[model samples]
Target: MKAMRLEAIGKLFVREVEKPVPGSEDLLVRVEACGICGTDRHLLHGEFPSTPPVTLGHEFCGIVEVVGEAVKGFKPGMRITGDPNISCGLCPQCQAGRVNLCANLKAIGISRDGGFADYVIVPQKQAFDIPLTLPPEHGAFCEPLACCLHCIDMARIKAGSSVIVLGGGVIGLLTVQLARLAGATTVILSTRQESKRRLAEELGATASFDPSEDDPIGGLAGLKGLLPGGADVVIECAGVRETVMQAPKLAKSGGTVVILGVLAQGEKVEIEPFDILFRELRLIGSFINPHTHRRAADLVASGKINVEKLISRKITLDEAPETIRNPARAGEIKVLVMAGT
Candidate 1:
């Protein structure tokens, strides 16, 4: 078997490795496709914490080649998507049903070996079965879409409400569609990239804006703007300091703001406490996918979410190391790593 190993921080290489075996409660999954996420770049750049000497891919899906003796409801040949976050069931947060906040969270790709290889061992509890009929790449999107679903749940969008999604990346684009499906009548997307802005509109954004050209908040939330008096909900998906700072200002006084972006550690932004107090706005920070992977798989399988259009390109595992090391190409949405390509 072959795997892309991160030998150390700032280093990655493709090398031959032994095929991983399933544990008592695990499944040996043959890697089909894995998406190259921003977190991979962050880990490589030391912007995010990750255990080195491990395979680096979390958003993955594949066919089960071997099932463990203790595993149930899963069999060889079944297609599944693994929720990489493995939480200790005995942790305080897990006991309270807040698994994402588990103190002993060990993500597969971040802490141990992952799906950026010929095989990955997935615990039965972390795997969600999906229809085998869908495209292989579609299954890899379950993880990201699951995270976006959590953000939508926190946003609490309502019928006829207004939504403004910051950034036009895959997360922003997916959030736009979910917001629309959640009953937000007026959905707006802000980004400097023209291609992304255009793509946002096609993906359910009622309107798109170029933040570089004008003030996104004022242009859309001002008294004379699109959704006068601000939007009912503002979701920041850009993960940039500017967008995080602008999120609150883009929301209506009593509206909500959800931070779905992943900012680098120790990053800081200036926000007005007085405004939040006076307006009574609800500001929330959304973390990784928690209890939403199943729903994400259902949505993708049902063809409700347009995962196909978001796939920018697919590359072989041999090309994955370079792809993860370099910055994403302009306007590229998602780059998938195809195992057998």
Candidate 2:
């Protein structure tokens, strides 16, 4: 089996490795497609906490090459995606249905071997059969779409509500569509990528702003007049500190601010205590998903979410390293690493 090993910070290489076997409750999946995430870069730079000598790729899907004993509803040939956030069902957070915050959580790409390889193991409970009707490449998007779904769930956007998405990366674009589906009447997108903004407009955004050239918060006044108060929710999907700090300011008084992006570990952004008190804003943080992955898979499989337009490039496993190294490659947004591409 060929696996891309992250032996240490600032290093990765493809190596021939022994294939893995599954436990009685596990399934061995042959990798088909994996999405390279920004966190992968963070892991490579030691900006995030990850055990060294690990293979890094969590957003992936594949066909079941072999099923361990007692793994039901799955056969050797079944195509599937799964919840990568492995949790101890006995933990307090897990018992409370907040498995994303479980004390004993072990993620596939972070803590164990992930899908950037020929074969990877997953617990049967976390694995879901990909709807056969959809293409395998789209199935690869299941995990990321699920993560965005979890973020949208945190906002609780009301119908006709005003919403803003900070950032136009893969997650930001996905968040725009979900905000529209939640019945938001006004969707404002802030991003520097002109190409991404155009795509966002085609999807559902009422207007797109280039935050690099102009102030995004300047438009909030008009958005406030459009809404009953202002934007009912602001979703910070950009992991940068500037965007994180701007989220609450973009919202109107009493509006909710959902911090959905994964900031680098130990990173901090300054915020005044008086601002929270004066605005009476709700500052909520959305971490990894809880249990919305299946719903996300269904949403994408059913064609309600138009993410195909968000995919800007497709490559094989051999191209993964270069893709990770150069993010500005010709309007790249959600580059799909299809098997044998």
Candidate 3:
């Protein structure tokens, strides 16, 4: 099997490797499609924590080529999406139903071998079944969509609520649609790329603005601004220091701010403590997908979330190493690696 192995920070390559074997309670999923995430680049650049000498692809979906004897309710030939974040059930956080904060959290792609290959092992518990009738590429979106669902749950968007989504990347675009579906009447997207701003508007953002052209705080929330007093909820998806620092300022006095972005480890940004205390704003951090993969798969299978339009391009596994090493292309959304291609 051909797999892209991350030998170490700043080193990655496509090498011929032995196929993975499934454990008693695992399923050997034949790689169909896997999306290249920003974390992949971070892992390559040592900006994110990841175990080297492993395959690095977490946002993956595939057909079950082989099912372990102990696995039940899942059979060979079934299509499924793998929830990469694996938590130790005995951990204190896991026992408290906070699996995302598990002390022994072991993500498939980050901590162990993951999809980006001909075959990858998926523990039965972490696999969510998706429709075999749907496009193979669409299944790769389940992981990202699940994460966004977590953000939406934290945001608690209500009917007629106003939203501001920072960044227009894949996560930002997906969030825009979810915010709208959650009954947010006004969903705004801010990005530096003009093309992404346009795409965001098409994806249900009530309005889209380029934050690079001017100061977002003054441009969007200034007197006689787009949202008079700021948005009811501000979701930061860019993972940039500027966006993270500006999130609270973009929120209304008592609004909610959710950090859905993955900033580099040890990164720091200046934020005003006085403003948060004075306004009584709620600032929350949303981590990996927890108990939302099934919902994400259902939404994709039922054609609720528009995953088709978010796909920017498709490449073969041989090209994945380079893709992960380089920064995302301008105005690009999701890039998928089609193993079959």
| lDDT per residue as tens, model 2, 1-341 | 88877888888877888999999989999988888888888887788878879877888888898888898889988888877888898988889988889899888887788888888898999888876667777877788888888888888888988898998888899999999998898998988889988999999999888877756555444554434355789999989899998888778898899998888889999987798899999999988768888898888888988867877778777777666765556557787777787
Determine which window of 10 residues in candidate 2 has minimal summed lDDT: 219-228
* Residue 274 accuracy (lDDT) in model 2: 92
lDDT tens readout by residue for model 1, 1-341 = 99999999889999999998788999999989999998898888778888898898999999999998999999999999999999999988999999999999999899999989989999999999999998989999999999999999988888998999999989999999999999999999999999999988988988988887767666555533597778899999988999999899888899999999888878899999999999999999999988999999999999999989999989999999999888889989999999777
TM-score of 2: 0.95
Scored by lDDT, model 1 comes in at 0.92
Per-model tally of clashing residue pairs:
0, 0, 0
Write one digit per residue (lDDT tens) for candidate 3, span 205-227. Answer: 98888777756667665633678
Q: Cα deviation in Å at residue 132, candidate 1?
A: 1.3
Q: What is the C-alpha lDDT of each candidate?
A: 0.92, 0.83, 0.92
Query: Could you give the C-alpha RMSD of every candidate to the true structure, in order shown?
Result: 1.3, 1.9, 1.3
Model 2 C-alpha RMSD vs. true structure (Å) is 1.9
Better of 2 and 3 by lDDT: 3
